[model samples]
Target: MKNNVKLARIKANLTQQQLADGVGITRQTISLIEKGKYNPSLKLCLQICYRVNAQLDEIFWISEEEFNSEENN
Candidate 1:
């Protein structure tokens, strides 16, 4: 999975800890999400999108290959 979380965070002028606090998660979790090292749940994704004023597709995206692979996996 790929996300534009870092971009959104920067655009919002929010630190990872601030974003985490607003989204009710840990700073490490926000760091992981920003780094694309972790995939957040759909609910968490929604919360993040809401806080950042981004659409779900804008934040979390499945590339063509990834979409295909996911169906098979």
Candidate 2:
């Protein structure tokens, strides 16, 4: 999955730690999400979207190919 977390956080003037704390996750988790190293659970994704004032699609996205591949996996 892809996410605009870094962009949104910067626009919101929130550090990774601040965002993580607000969403009850570790800063490392936030970093991984920003870098696309980890896929957040639906609940966490919702929390992030809400806290960052972005729509779910604006924050987290899966390309058609990726979606297909994930289904295969």
Residues 1-73 of candidate 1 have per-residue lDDT tens digits of 5679999888888888888999999999998888767889999999998888889998898799987785676
- Model 2, 1-68: lDDT tens per residue? 56799999898889999999999999999999898789998999999988888898887776899878
In terms of lDDT, the best-performing candidate is 2
Off by over 4 Å in 2: 66-73
Lowest summed lDDT across 10 adjacent residues in model 1 is found at 64-73
Q: Model-by-model lDDT, in order?
A: 0.87, 0.88
Instruction: Provide the global lDDT of candidate 1 against the true structure.
Output: 0.87
In model 1, which runs have C-alpha deviations exceeding 4 angstroms? 66-73
TM-scores vs. true structure, each candidate: 0.83, 0.83
Clashes of 2: 0
